[model samples]
Target: MAAPTAWIVAAAPLAAALSALAAAFVTGFDQRSAMPPDLAARFYGFFLDRYPLFAFAIPYGVARLLAVALAPGRSGALRRVIGAALGLGLLLGLSLHPTFGGMVLRAGFGTGSGAFLNGTPMAAAYAFGAAAAAGLFGSALGLGAALIGRPGTPRPGSRRRRAGRAILHALAGFLALWFAAALIGLAHDAGFGPWPRRPLDARDAAIAAGLLTAGALPHLLLVAARLRRATRAA
Candidate 1:
């Protein structure tokens, strides 16, 4: 059976954004907890972090989807331009958000009213920045993949294959790091871990690592799949 068109188009970006936000929120809430910890707070933090990624991915993914929907022999120049512009605009807009702008000003100049925001807002700002960075980077990568896998692109036997393999290998390494961090966090929570030597620190690291890994999985899978398809096409 054929897959739904919308799902096919949105799957990668949606997965990427959701996974990253999930990890960030889980970590943020875990760190902020006191006493018994608040599930509601955690959920709130998750949604807060999720909004930027979702917002950013929608336009970016839609642009890419439109590009892919074009005729196979058609030049992708316009699509590429649109994708880059949209990705950049989205990141720039997020960077300009008051909470994020304040955070950056505080970090870079150390001369802003960090008092402008606190707690979830502050966390969301950070999440927005991180998501933006990832989105931009992923967009660039998507462009590269599209170029390399273009309908009539040339394929240099070992070199092209080697490059593709290397990219996949790097992704695997990242996944391993994230998995290990998650395990470490789990162990610490269970009262049997080392390295971090502090419960809170371990928990934070684990949550972040696990979430990042999860977020990256979709991109890695998409790239790998593209490479396979390109190889076959060649």
Candidate 2:
């Protein structure tokens, strides 16, 4: 990969993270208040209910696809598998959009009497689903790009090879981050750890932010290690 292409590939994850962060703020969830289980469930449901899938998910998929297309790497049969998964994920994500059937489900099944079964549990499931969709979309894009674009030849001081490796490392970091976030949410819901309570005041917000950073550290370390390896190889 050329310097320009490497930078472009790196932008995908950055864009995704920024978009999600912005969405959180826009939804006024930057400082959530703690609630009982029932209320928590409804909150989760309504939160997902109003989410803008098009603003985030669709663009995320497109950016990842572009990243893969422009990245230099060797393609294989695995690319086909990844592409298929990407298609399926995108379809599911579209179906889960608020304006589609997801709205009905949220209103009918995610609130009121039906909410007991559909609220927090459904929200948790959706979180996992969204993460899976994002991962599959990104992997497919990267894999497809490697297949359709120039293949990197591994040799001494090969920039293309370095770029390809860097992309893989970045993808791994993204996956790690996603899984870590999901696990943190699950643990909080399960009452496993000292998760910050709602009404996230300054102290609570600081604690929550610190916990999130701690959770992400391992993934960041792995990314740093991979980059070091890539540099050494180059």
Candidate with best lDDT:
2
TM-score of predicted structure 2: 0.37
Predicted candidate 2 versus true structure: per-residue lDDT over 1-234, tens digit per residue: 454444455455436544554544445452255456664553344334333222234344454454454455655546634654555455444435543323322333234334335555766555555465345444544444444543334436579876786677657756764654444334334333222222223443333334444444555455335334444445
* Clash totals for all candidate models: 0, 6
230 in model 1: Cα distance from truth in Å? 2.3
lDDT of 1 by residue, 98-186 (tens): 43332222232221113224434644444444433433434443454354233222344688786886567456533432332222223
- Which residue pairs clash within candidate 1? none
* Top-scoring candidate (TM-score): 2
For candidate 2, the per-residue lDDT at 50 reads 35
The TM-score values for the models, in the order shown, are 0.28, 0.37
> Looking at model 1, which ten-residue stretch has the lowest summed lDDT?
104-113
Model 2: residues with Cα > 4 Å off, grouped in runs? 1-182, 187-204
